[model samples]
Structure formats: structure tokens, C-alpha cells
Target: MERGNRRNALWLKQVIVLDSSLLIAFKIKNDSHHERANALMKQVVSERFGKPSITSYIFDETVTGIFVKSKSLRLAVEYGNELLASLETLEVSEEAFREAWKIFSEQRNRRLSFTDSSTLAVMKIHDIGRIATFDEDFGNIEGINAIGLV
Candidate 1:
């Protein structure tokens, strides 16, 4: 019984998927969601929780968008680099893709964007039950749980 409990504890500490909104919010200091995202990130990075992970696609999407919108290139680059460094990169797998496709098909009328679909895919594949996103669309996604601030 003790061994089983220990195993469950260990499994619960595994990686949790990080979303692009979280990174973007964390990087842009003035954004309304910045503080919320930062607080959530701190918990993820703390000793008791699992490490933060995101797909490479999310990485590119966030870093590019953040930097592009920033007036100060240097500051944007610095924040973007720091945000990227804090995360563990996960490569999207075939299984993830299939699951995302299924979600998309089921919600075809909703018109879920590719970005959110990909994130949902990664979450389903990795058994990640929570996502740190500021977008409500993520919450609408079935199967994948979203941790949006809304």
C-alpha cells in the first residue's frame, strides 16, 4: 500500500503542458493577464509541482508574437529568452496529432484555431489535465482541461 501511494505521488509530479498565452502573458509586463500568468508559472516552477512543458510550435508562436509586438526589441528578446528558458520543450507526437484532429472534427462548427488545437493535442497525448491559457477557446475544448484566468 505504501509503495502504491508513492507511485501515485510520483506520477502526479510529472510534467504539465504550458500554453502560449501563459508565456506571452508572462513576458509582456503591461498585459492584464501578466500577473495572473506569472503567479501560475511560479507555482509550476515551485518544488512541489511538475515542470512546465510546451510544444515547439507554441514556443515559436509565443516568442515571435511577443517580440513582434514589443516596441523595444531588446526587452522583448530578453523576456522572450527568459520565458523560453524556464520551460521544458515537448515534441508533438502522432498520437497527439490524431487526438487533436478528433477534437477538431467533433467541434468543426466551432471553428477552433490550429494553435489551440495543437495545444489541446499535446495535452491529450501527455495526459496533462491542466493548461495555463488566457483564452476562453481552450476551455471549450473537450477532453483537454484549460486553466484560463477567466
Candidate 2:
């Protein structure tokens, strides 16, 4: 592909809504996918993927992961703060909660975490179809596309 075509392809993909797992992977240096995740982040931020946003659930998860998984609490806090500063925080609204509740209740065979559903709800509200997530569960959903695993 031509260089312009490649750039256009990447830009036309979709907005990226980052899940906790992917954000944690980017935050914690030890994460196996850190390099790839970091490269993705660099491109997304520099190129501008319709302004990235992370649900509050994901923000909490990142901080908790750092505290629980990292070797040093101080280091974890440092990185956690850095990550928090960078993200656009999205609060879970009543409508989002209701939507998530409906999605979970309708899916008898699958279990969706309230947090995960909330993230999906945000994407739905914002008209975002793409997400950065390590979990494969999002792919099972009809409208949203999980870009990280792909």
C-alpha cells in the first residue's frame, strides 16, 4: 500500500475506547504487550483518534492493578497518576447503567461485567465502534468492534 493509503486506513478505522486491561498493559512496564500497546497509544494520541476516553471503571482498575501487581507502591502510584492525568474520564451515567443492565439481562448465555457493559454503553452513546481491549468478549457484541485483539 502507498504511505498515504496506510495512514488513511489507520485513521479511518474508528475511535478507540480503551478498556482497563489494555490501559494497564500500557501502564505497567512488565505487561507482555507493553511495547505493542505503547506503540498503539503513541500513534492514537499523536494521530488523534477522535479524542480518546476511558471509563471511570477503567481508571479505577488501572490504579488498583498498579497497587496490587507492581513491585513498588510508590512506582505504581507515580505511573497511576500519570495515566490518570492523560486519560479523558467518562463517568457512568444513569442511561449507560440502564443500557448495560439490559444488555446483561438479555444475554442469558453470557455474563457481562457492569463495568464492561458501562464501557460499551459509553461507546454507544459516543457513536464509537472501536475499542482497545484484551478481552475477547466485546467481539461477541453486535455493534462494537474490538481492535486490540485484532
Compose the digit string of candidate 1's lDDT tens values, residues 24-77. Answer: 888788888888988887786783346667787787778776877676768767
Go through the candidates in order and give each one's C-alpha lDDT: 0.71, 0.74
Instruction: Give the runs in model 1 whose Cα sits over 4 Å from its true position.
Output: 1-13, 47-49, 71-73, 105-111, 140-143
Candidate 2 total steric clashes: 0
Looking at model 1, the pairs that clash are none
Supply every candidate's count of residue pairs whose N, Cα or C atoms clash at under 3 angstroms.
Answer: 0, 0
Q: What is the C-alpha RMSD of each candidate to the true structure, in Å?
A: 4.3, 7.2
lDDT of 2: 0.74
TM-score of every prediction relative to native: 0.74, 0.77
Candidate 2 off by > 4 Å: 1-15
Query: How does candidate 2 fare on TM-score?
Result: 0.77
